[model samples]
Target: MMNTWITASAVAVIAGVTGFFAVLRGSTFAAHAIPNGAFAGAAGASLLGINVIWGLAVFAVAGALGIGALGRRARHDVVTALALVLMLGLGALFVSVSTEYADETYSLLFGEVFGVSGAEVLPIAGLGIASIAVIGAVFRRLMLASAMPEVADARGVSTRSLEVYFLVVMALATSMTVPVVGALLMFSLMIGPAAAARSFTGRPGLAMALSVAIALVTVWAGIALSYRTNWPLGFYVGVMGAGFFLLGRCWAAVRQRRAVASPLPVLPNESGYLPGLIALPCRRPCCAGRSAVPAVLLCRPLCPARASAQPAAPAAPDNFPQKTAAGLLMARRGESSVCDDETSDVWPQLWPGSRRTRCDGFRLHRRR
Candidate 1:
């Protein structure tokens, strides 16, 4: 039981960390397929009378390279699916031909966490450490590549090389985790906790911490529950991981709703420019004598009472028609020449003591 706990926890940590990048890189399907491919390696190892771990490592690394090569031509999901189907077919063939210890193959497909011994612990820990070190070394490059490949490429980062390196690291981690979690449930550990953590937080560091914590808790609790209830450990782990993901989705939904209800403040600079109130160049002849008055005033809404209080002014002649805000031309006597009712009062405020006359349009009148 102690050995089982140690192995499961170590595998959980590796999967949690690797899964963060898997989700970030949108290579979750590849994460799933790699473990199953490694499972095929285990089957082949059994048939060939070799150490299963070596077989798992070889096949996983090969599959990673194969996927990377294929990804250059096709979509990632398509490449991953092709690899997954091919590996599953190979695993089925290897299993069919092997007659001895057929029941043991079931254990490999599911898991044998309780069967883990002290001898296996050192290797598992070493592999887990190696995986973590590799991830740490390429963390920045991986993040830059995942977020914006074009930008990373422009900045002299070899995105393709980084991608292949990342995939190789994931392959190694998958190989180590398969024996403990089973190839079938390996993706659950690799994707579920990290996906849930991502939903709960936008910050990458905090999300990674949450992912590791969630995976640890899920593994420990699953082992305890399986021990007490006499159920399969994989079943408990899968259920717990899926439940956490659903809970995270619910939390994220609540946050989105709250954000929509109370949006962030919009600064003056952020506000859209008003199309009706454009500041034109001040070069009109009408504005020559008056420096205080602008050349063109795109009038907005003004007080209605001010519009009514102002004395009526004579309109311009037929030859010199004035354009109003409403696109109407006024050529009548003693009628307001302003186009829109909203800006009618504002024009009087701008041109104080200026009256519309028949001879000179609007001339400024001096107070007697």
Candidate 2:
């Protein structure tokens, strides 16, 4: 039981830390692939009468490199799937050749945390610490690269290098974690807490802290519950992982609803206008792109969606376009933009002729 706790705790910490970056980097698929590919390593190790960790590590690193070499955002999953197929094929060959692999194989498939020896705890803990330290050193750079690639590029961060570094780290962590949580359940443990943390706060530091805390709690609770119920620890861990993610989704939904129900008031500038809020959303039946947000909440006048919407404009020229500005503004007139008032500088934004000086920019076409 003590060995079980120690080993599980070490693996949990590794999963928690690497999982945060995995989710941030959008490498959750890679996370799943690395360990699945490493399954063959465990089989080969058992056949050779060697430790499973060494086998898993070698194959996991290879899988990570293969993915790193081929992966790109647009078609990353396809590459990951290819790696998975190759690894699984190798695993099948290893399994079919061995008659003594049944018990060891089942243990690998479902995890046997209780069967872990005291000798295994030290290596797992030491390796877990090393992985965490490496992650912490590159945490900020990785976050920038993952969240804002353009900004990272401006700072001279190599996105390709970061991607390969992260995948290798994840591969190492997954190899160690598979012994405790099983390959099938390890991905859930990695993604669950980190994804849930993302919902509560967008700050990377706070979310990482939350992810670790959640993972620790989930592992501890899963162990305790498994002990009491005499059930498999991996099952409980997998369930808790999914439950935490769903809870995060529910929390995010609630926060979003509250924000919509009582929106923050936009402050009025000296000109009683805001730059991005210059025009109200279009209300024409053809303009289905209008935001669902209520216009009254964002600006002074009611939205076109409301029956008693305000009139076109007010007497004060300071608030020139007013709220129903888009309603009155013409989208186009021949080659240039059109405006209700010729002198007003405001024009329909994000259009071809939006920068036109005035509605008279183009002459009306005449059939000669």
Candidate 3:
């Protein structure tokens, strides 16, 4: 049982991380296909009395390379068709062969909880660690390349090499998990935890961490339950992993909704330009007048004379918007003096006296 726990933990960790990368690469279906193809190879290896892990790993690497070669053309239909043929045809072939190992065959097919040994756990753990190391070494590069492959190519990032590297890591990791988790349940082990993590956290590192946590919990919990109740371990783990995803999404949605509806303090320089408006310097990050922001917040009522009469604070940089926090638009040196009615109508609505006045649809107005 202890050995089984270690092996399962190793498999779950590999699956969780690789699955995240699979989703990131838009290769979720490919993740599915590789395992199915590997299972076929494993069955064939069993028939020939060859090493099962080696057979599956070799085939998985080849399948991953093939999928990578197909690249953009590896569509959903293609992946599904290939996976179906590999899974069913190999199972049928394995069944037709006479074997003293009928129980072993079924165990490999559906998986067996008690089958994992202490000897097996170390190697699988090594495989998982190696896979994670590869991912870690190239994570930043992968993220950059993935975000803009064309740009990355232009910048000499070798997008093809990175793709091949990721595919290889994915193949190794997926194969490593097969014996412990079974081909059918492997994709769930990979995709579910990562998805749950993503749903809960926007930060990539935190998301992956959460995925590993979820995987560990589900795998261990499933093991405990399976041991006690004699239920199918794979089925339980898969279901729990899926449950985590749904729960994370729900939690994230609730949090986002609360944030969107909650009113908070805003900055005045957030507005771009109202016909009678000007941009202001907002001292707050929470205020809207950030550089590159389309809209800015401003003071609603314009009282330039009053504003001028009031004590002056430290002047912001010359590049700062000429609007005051109270919504008075200040004239810039050697700039256009014309103010139009069209600009006045476009500001955002604020308190009773304050409305979004448009300065080229960029300025905002705040109440005094």
Q: How many residue pairs clash in each candidate?
A: 2, 0, 26
Indicate which candidate wins on TM-score. 2
TM-score of 1: 0.70
* Backbone clash total, candidate 3: 26
lDDT tens digits, residues 301-345, model 2?
A: 222222123243222233223223232122111122223353232
CA lDDT of 274 in candidate 2? 22
Candidates sorted on TM-score, descending? 2, 1, 3
Identify the superior model by TM-score, candidate 2 or candidate 3: 2
Model 3 misplaced stretches (Cα beyond 4 Å):
72-80, 83-91, 94-105, 261-368
The global Cα lDDT (0 to 1) of model 1 is 0.67
List model 1 lDDT by residue over 139-224, tens digit each: 76776567545445654789898999999899988776677668766678878899898877765667778898999999899889
Q: Which stretches of candidate 2 lie over 4 Å from their true place?
A: 72-74, 260-368
Q: What's the distance in Å from true for residue 338, model 2?
A: 19
Model 1: weakest 10-residue lDDT segment is 286-295
Candidate RMSDs in Å, in order, are 18.7, 11.0, 12.5
Clashing residue pairs found in predicted model 2: none
lDDT of model 2 at position 287: 20
